[model samples]
Target: MRRHRRAKIVATVGPASAAPDKLRALFLAGVDTFRLNFSHGLQEDHARVHAAIRALEQEVGRPIGILQDLQGPKIRIGTVKDGRLDLTAGETVRFVLDGSEGDKQAIPLCHPEIFAAAAPGQDLLIDDGRIRVRVVGLDADTLTAEVITGGPVSNRKGVNLPGTLLDLSPLTPKDRADLAFGLELGVDWVALSFVQKPSDVVEARALIGNRAGILSKIEKPQALERIGDIIRLSDAVMVARGDLGVEIPHEDVPGRQKELIRACRLAAKPVVVATQMLDSMVAAPAPTRAEASDVATAIYDGADAVMLSAESATGQYPVEAVTMMDRIIRSVEGHKLYRSIIATSDPGEEETPPHAVASATATLAEAVQASAIVTYTTSGTTTARVARKRPAVPILALTPHLATARRLCLMWGAHSVHTDDVDSYEEMTTKAADCAVQEEFARSSDLIVTTAGIPFQMAGNTNNIRVIQIQ
Candidate 1:
């Protein structure tokens, strides 16, 4: 199916929408990618979903991106006494390594690394910042903290320390196993959660290597300090605002989101703005006005894609949520101001081969008013570069590698199609133009611009650009 707008949509798979037909409906509803949350289902369950997605890809004759989100390090308070305990302001609570049920005096914190790295005066926020405490002291066996914003602390509630950089890797044992499964399934993208430094990306990259794209989920406060380096190191970035909002104030999320989108755009990296875009649809058939506005805001801000988490995973109206989001994106993009807003962020002044070719493609397409810009890619880099320009026309990325086409789904204005390798320039144009026509992006006699390397056998050698009119 064809999308009218530039930005893409990501629908998460869960029990609510796991059927083969249901997933196919989601793809028809404009879901460019499917996110399998490892935090929820079993390996077997995700394997089923993965197989189902590949089946749909074959049936529809398209490249559908599969993103496996890893459940990163788990920092939480252990079991609480009486099932839960309430702490009052001015009261001190002890977090011990030994798991035990206790009263208001001490709670269980089994993670020894947290106690080791945690220092005095560091604030600890639990349950998404509902209960706040400040680490007053730390010893070999315990972490003494004072209740600053007291509330009910339950068993295994998430702990967020915005101050200190906890000594932890972005992956766990479960994540390692999940990574293996995802790679084996030919997953397109692997989202690393709770990324702190560039090393996190390096660590995950070392394991994933060239098998998949590493998308750093920026949700930790430490990540913000070195966001540029992380973006440079990562293949892509996702503004995972769910945890980010907890680590920082709600007011700061919007600014951070804008900053990240702009940074990624400048760096020519695909970025996804995720978390609660259409949250109300989880229960209601229609989204709240605020949620609708939120989706529009991401589109107008030039995000590559807006994600639907629980809304599509377990919502009462999964199809409606995606349809509504699609409508919102088209409506906002249809506005006369859409291109003007996007034009304000001009392409950078870089003379690199990729940048130069991408810039020329955009300029040439605009000059001729080409029906579309056709890109033959093997690693999705050329498509990403062209997307950063935000051309007025749609970008048709034709890739021989299914994974490359699938990974391009998260880029703005890119419509990916899997096609055979082009042995010559003549064959490349003919195949790309044919795929475009089949995709209904352009009709006969329509003007189009095609880009690729001279030696079709070589990669990243995009030194050629041509304009063609369909016969």
Candidate 2:
């Protein structure tokens, strides 16, 4: 199906929307990708959902993307006295590397990485920053801190060390197992969480090995410090604002989101703005105005996709949430100021032949008011480059590889079609025009722009651009 909006929607599948009929409804409501969160549900649950999605894909005759989001290392305090502890602002709390339950005087924090990496004056936020503490002293096995913001600390509350970089892998043992299961299920995208450095992405890439697209979730402050390297290494990026807001100043998130989006655009990689796009929709039928504005802002910033977490996973109105997001994107893109805003924020083309050709194709298509920009892509690179320009016309990406078509579902403005590989220029032109007509992207006598590499079926060699008029 051809989406009216350029930006895509990613919906998480859970108990609320796990049935085949619900999945199909979500897809029809404009969900381009489905996210399977390993943080919850069993492997068998995900397998069933995966099977249903594949069936839906065949039924609709469209490529649908599936993203497996790994639950990375989670550091949390051990059991507390009476299941909770009430702390005062000036009270001193002692945290020890023990598994035994204790009172406020000696709270057990089982994670050793936090104790080893934490230093005096570094802040420790618990329960999503509801209770804050700053370390004042530390020993080999214990960390003493005074409460900066006092609150009721409960058992197993999550810990966030914004100022310290723990020597830990983003992929936990469970994540590795989950990754294996997802790869076996043939997922199109793998979202690596808790990415603190570039090495985290490298480690994931080693296991992924081109089987799936590696998307790094930028939710840690340390990741932002080395974002350039992280973005360069990963196939795509996600502005994970939920945990990110807890780690950094809430005011800094919008600027960081824009920076990450621009960086991904420069690299011609897909970027998703995730976490609570329509949070209130989890309970309410419609989203709050602020939530709608939030989704529009991401689209205006040129985000490739906006995602729904709990809003679609366990929400009361999962299909309505996707429909609302789709409507918001269409409205924002149709606004008179959108084109100018996107043009102003353009990262421009890189100094490469492929990039030059892609940029020229976009420019020429707009100059001629072409009906569509048809791209003959083997590795989806040529289509991605054209999408990065955010052209006015639609983009029809024809590729022989179904994986390429599925991966391109997350890219902005690219409607992917899995077609047979063309061997010559004549075949390429004929196939592009035929697919455009078949896909309802063009009609007889309509002008269209086509781009491809000279060597057929070779990846990343976009050195040719052609303008054709359908007969």
Candidate 3:
């Protein structure tokens, strides 16, 4: 099937939309990909979803991508004895790491690493900031805290420490197991949540190997601090606005989203803007006007995909949400500004090697009226940079890395092909032309634009460019 919308729609699956029939309906409603949140679903549930997606792909006669989102190191308070507690502002609370358990006055802190890392005066947000506390004292057995802001605290509530760095690894055992399971299922993409540094991507890649593409969720401020490195290392990126909005100032999210998208575009890595795109649809059949504008903005900003969180997974109007997002993307893409926004570039004064090559390729594509632009990328940087230019013709990205292929599935106007990396420029150009013809992106006589580097450098080392006729 030909994609009608420039920006893809990624719908999450949950109890409300997990059935095969419902999944089929969603696929028909214009959901290009299905997201399986490993955090909530069991292994059996994932298997069922996987089977359903495969069945639908066959029925629809189109490749439908499946993204398995791994729940990385999720920090939460242990179970509360009473199931719920009310804390008044300025009230002192004590969190003890004692395994003894059970208490009406205090909650058990099972994460000793958290206690060791937290310092006095640091802020702790519990349950998405429903309850806020400040560390008052630290001890061997207990850590004292005072309620800075009061609200209802429930069992196993999530804990967020913004400034306080935790002394825990990014990937938990559960995430590792989930990665293996996702690979076994042949999932197209695996999204790693709460990625803090570039090393997280490296580790996940080592485990996943080439089984699937890794899409790092940029929800932590630490990730933003190391975004350039993370983008360089990751296959793709997701601007996970849910936790990100909570971690950083709410006003900063828009700028951060734009910055991340721009960076990914320059690197040619596909970026997805996720979370709460049509949240109101969880209850209502339609989205709010603001939500509609939000989705449109992402499309205009040249995001590869706009993701639906609970709106599609557990909302009553899952199908409607996907349909709405598809409509909005199509409508916005029709505008001249949409393409203009994507093609616009901010080439720094002293251009980096990747940037210089990307700019040259874009210029050559425009000048030659190329039937297609073929990019050889290892880490997806060159592909993303070329995509940001938004050439009128198709962009065929050939990567030896399967992770890059799956991750590029979300990119606007990009068709990723998995192939072996060539050692020389001539081999790279010939192979790229062959791929373009095989994919029907270019005819035998059509001109094609190709980009790569000499001496067979790493994935992002795109320092050469050529225009060749397909034969």
Best by TM-score: 2
lDDT tens per residue, model 2, 150-184? 99988889999995789999999999999999999
TM-score of each: 0.97, 0.98, 0.84
Q: Whole-model Cα lDDT per candidate?
A: 0.88, 0.94, 0.82
Deviation in angstroms for 103 in model 3?
A: 4.4
Off by more than 4 A, model 1: none
69 Cα displacement, candidate 3 (Å): 1.1
- Residue 323 lDDT, candidate 2, scale 0-100: 95
Q: Candidate 2: which stretches are off by over 4 Å?
A: none
306-356 per-residue lDDT for model 3 (tens digits): 899899888988999988888898899887776666656432322677777
Worst 10 residues of 3 by lDDT: 342-351
lDDT of 1 by residue, 290-375 (tens): 98889988888889998989998988889898899899999999998988888886646567886889889988999999999998
Residue pairs with colliding backbones in model 3 are: 213-403, 267-381, 268-383, 268-384, 268-385, 269-384
At residue 137, what lDDT does model 1 achieve?
Answer: 88
